[model samples]
Target: MTHIRNIYCIGLNYVKHAAEMGNRVPEEPLIFSKPTHSFVKTDGNPIELPADKGEIHFETEIVLYIDKKPDPEFKVEDVVGKIALGIDFTLREVQTKLKQNGQPWLRAKGFKNAAVVTDFWDYPGTDICRNTEFSLVKNNETVQQGKAENMIFDFHELIKECDENFGLDQGDLIFTGTPEGVGKTEDGDEFILIWDGKEKGRFVTNLK
Candidate 1:
């Protein structure tokens, strides 16, 4: 099964998303992980919602496919194998409650079909920052747009910080945090991730 061996995620990599979520932009990157098997690709099944987790939100993000084997001594530019667009599904209500109680949000963030990844491209390390643009279109209207220029930690810096905290392994995937326009997903919502002005792939969600 061509699946990720490990998964590392950057939380609030965008300042606007952090402000919208009532969090301060951190001095350092906040990290999380999902099960490698949670990656839902093109042939992957539609996203299924949990029955009781209120306000399921879709966080459209940039995904990095790690290239090399796990190496604590590796450089930032050598870490990413490829780059893609992905959606990080979150049980927003559950997350808020967990935050209130000072609890870890693994259950709220990591669930079956949690990581939805689109197609990937070999974005050269030198040129990723000057990206043309990427956007998420819901039901045929653009809902979220992201650019590498807007990222708080950017590409090389994010990879460097992530590798410092968690030694990235081969078959590892990194979910860069979403930008501002996150919201609830209704049944029949069609999400298309467009990369560099082209349609990469899409993920449709089902209501509970």
Candidate 2:
């Protein structure tokens, strides 16, 4: 795997996800980030999470891998070389408190192994991708599903926002927000990421 330079994440990008979180659809992308230390691949080994942190929730999302710095007028096809399904694990109670205090989400969202992704596949261009549906199965149950078409800020828009605000670098990653149906996780929970109706990756949880 390429060494990750930075990890950027979008919030409230999905319409149903916004509603489920009791948040209004954002006019622009609500951006956040996780540290590189949080990165982990879904290699079948158990993923360790904080056990004492109250209620960690799973947010399944489509992750984009930037191959190089994008040009000013770059399209999604120009910079994104690969794609994968990932989970943006969150400490629910900690995140709630952080939000109430108007604080950054790093503490709640940037824990170790919090950013989990599958092995990437070559991006098949935006047309096919926009129509593709990806899903997450938790403990043998389909918990969340999403497609790029439902994003409030689509892939192009997201890349533009990142370039304009954060300046995209090679190996940077973006978690393009999650869909609705996010719920609490537990010890021994297993997560499977399915794309194009095939199991792409999976990992079991080990709360510590």
Candidate 3:
């Protein structure tokens, strides 16, 4: 049997995404989670889209792959660890309805193949904390664009918050959240996830 862990996510970490959602300035960072089975890796494998869902939206985020077991008495600065790259695929319509009804974001965010990630890489560097452009494209047309500097809670704070509630351990993943300009994608669309000043990865999905 395949081992499954936990999927932790940050909501509206990007200020522009908050504005796009018509939310007033937030008092604290928004948090959510997806099950371990939600993870998908592109090792020359095909990703299948949900047949029952409509207009699947793309939310490009910086995903951190935890490698250390969190210590109860650890300081926030000590949380530094390896991170992976990935895109957070969201069902916008479902998410909107859930929000209006004051419900949890699980159903809207935790579907199969909803979180697509790449192989883990060592923590890029401290500069990734200040400013880094992240974007997504479909068929060469950019759909979402954002910067890490726009996050309400930077990397350090994000890791701290996660540690406070749930102790992070090896193989755990955290999606920091997406930026503004998110939109829909039709079947047969080739999507690309790009992190500024780094390598870009591409994947194609079809509506089944």
Go through the candidates in order and give each one's C-alpha lDDT. 0.79, 0.93, 0.75
Model 3 has a clash total of 0
Please, what are the lDDT tens digits per residue for candidate 2 over residues 97-163?
9999999999999999999999999989998889999999998999998899988889999998988
For candidate 1, the TM-score is 0.91
Using TM-score as the measure, the top candidate is 2
Candidate 3 stretches with Cα past 4 Å from truth are 1-4, 72-78
TM-score of each: 0.91, 0.98, 0.88
Which regions in candidate 2 have their CA more than 4 angstroms from the true location?
none
Give residue 126's lDDT in candidate 3 (0 to 100): 54
**Candidate 1: 10-residue stretch with minimal lDDT:** 123-132
For candidate 1, the lDDT comes to 0.79
lDDT of 2 at 106: 93
- Ranking of all predicted structures according to lDDT, beginning with the best and ending with the worst: 2, 1, 3
How far out, in Å, is residue 67 in model 2?
0.8
